[model samples]
Target: MQPCVLTSTGGAPVAARFHAPPGAVRGAVVIGGAMGVKQDYYAHFAQWLSEQGYLVASFDYRGMGDSQRGSLRRLRADLFDWTDDFDTVIAEALARSGGAPLYLIGHSLGAQLPGLLKHRDRVDGLLSVAAGSGYWRDNAPQLRRMVLYFWHVLVPVATRLFGYFPGRKLRKVGDLPAGVVMQWRRWCMNPRYHVGAEGAPVREKFEAARFPVVALSITDDELMTERGTQVLVDCYANAPRRVERIAPADVQARRIGHFGFFRDQFQSSLWQRALTQLQAFRSPGETRDPADGISSRVAPGLLTAH
Candidate 1:
């Protein structure tokens, strides 16, 4: 793993890390993180993907984790800037890919906003984990229980008081720029989510996306529900997609929440599952989409945690 810094299109610094295999490279992966998550949080997964002969890149959005330089108020970024950051990371991964198939492994907000990418055509596929539309009405039971207060009272009051959302200190969401929190709150409150709130242009972007997607939805996800996940995936109307709704028992685990899939303990199970699904997309040299098949290669071991 090598630490690096990337410059966003907006000319802001973005923190990132790159992982490469020792031998032949079969594919490339860009791991777009959940909101407030750092690029370092995915180090283990990136290392494992590299071991599988993939060129893996992970990055932090501005005002989150290592990308946040000094003060939150000093940062001028919203979700749009973060999408630009993701685009920058993807571009780097694609350049280093050397014609190998490049996939985006997006988590939560990471997946939701890919429609905004200017270079979506360059990506081969997307692996969405616990990603959702963030419509409060369709959120997971836990989030739905408190959605009103979070959107109406807390987010507004907190952002105004601090000039930023101190999610890390509050233990609500993670820390975020005030613009990000406000814009995100608007998305959550709207029944149609970001697309509905942002208007026709955003919807057109989603409609324009054509890359195949593998959406992994966790039944035990504390924030995203099956409906929410599907809603987000459905936004990519022209894209061929396979949505896997998995409960803990389905993978022979005690519990796999929204965040648990990234834990090292599930490396052999969920991680390998992701690898197989991405492999099914297309290998290094070939270009066209394969059978969209994942089950034949998903081993029996996936049913048991060894």
Candidate 2:
């Protein structure tokens, strides 16, 4: 895997890893993951895609992972910042590959970011893994949800008021960027800011997107409920679209809950399915579509929707 850095207009450095597939490369895929998650976390998954004859580039957004950190003191992380950062990644990837068929694989927030980049024509396909409408209605019990909301409001306030706010330990992850955490707070409290669902009209920035799309969500994702996934599915009004759902039990014993989908233990489980969806679009003489995003394979599974 070769390492590269994309410098964005915002003066942030985006770290990227590029893996050339064995033999002749059939296609290329750019991967993006959830918040506070690093690109290295998907190393096994990237290797798997590379083995399947794909040149894959996985990268960390500015202020996250190996890239430069943002001003945490100001709590300024926003989707626009990451979107611009991703724009640089796409430009560099295309320039380096010389216009190879490109696909996108975005998990969680990464999945949603591309929706904001619909005007960019650098991708041929898209795979939205565990991407959902940004509503926290079913995130937890009413009491727990209320507590979370209260904390969302209180923490930022206290942080500004007293310079520090109590934070929960992220699940095996690092600290959340202040901007990202604050944006999440606004998103959770309102359903309109949700992705892949009814909300603000497609921004003028994304109207250029007309490529084929596939959005998938897992049933057992503790962070996003089935309803939230459906909301995302409903947002895509374009043709050549497909939506897939995976119940936790369907993923064998792997328990592909949220982050588990890309983890090593569940490679053959969920990752295989994702790959199959990608391969389905690839043919011997076919060039890549600019909207198709993911290129993973799928193995046997019994994912039934409730």
- All candidates' lDDT scores? 0.83, 0.65
Model 2 lDDT at residue 59: 87
Give each model a TM-score: 0.92, 0.80
Q: After best superposition, candidate 2 residue 167: deviation in angstroms?
A: 5.1
- Runs in model 2 deviating more than 4 A are 69-71, 74-76, 138-147, 158-174, 194-208, 283-306
lDDT of 1: 0.83
**Candidate 1: clashing pairs of residues:** none
RMSD of each: 5.7, 5.4
Clashes of each: 0, 24
Among these predictions, the greatest lDDT belongs to 1
| Per-residue accuracy of model 1 over 1-306 as CA lDDT, tens digit each | 877888997788888888998887777789999987877779999999899999999988986777878999877788888899999888887667666667889999889988889978767778999998898889877777788998899899988999899887899878899989999988987878988999999899988987777799998999888888888888887777768888999778999998999999889899999989888776344453323312112222222211
State, as a TM-score between 0 and 1, how close model 1 is to the true structure. Answer: 0.92
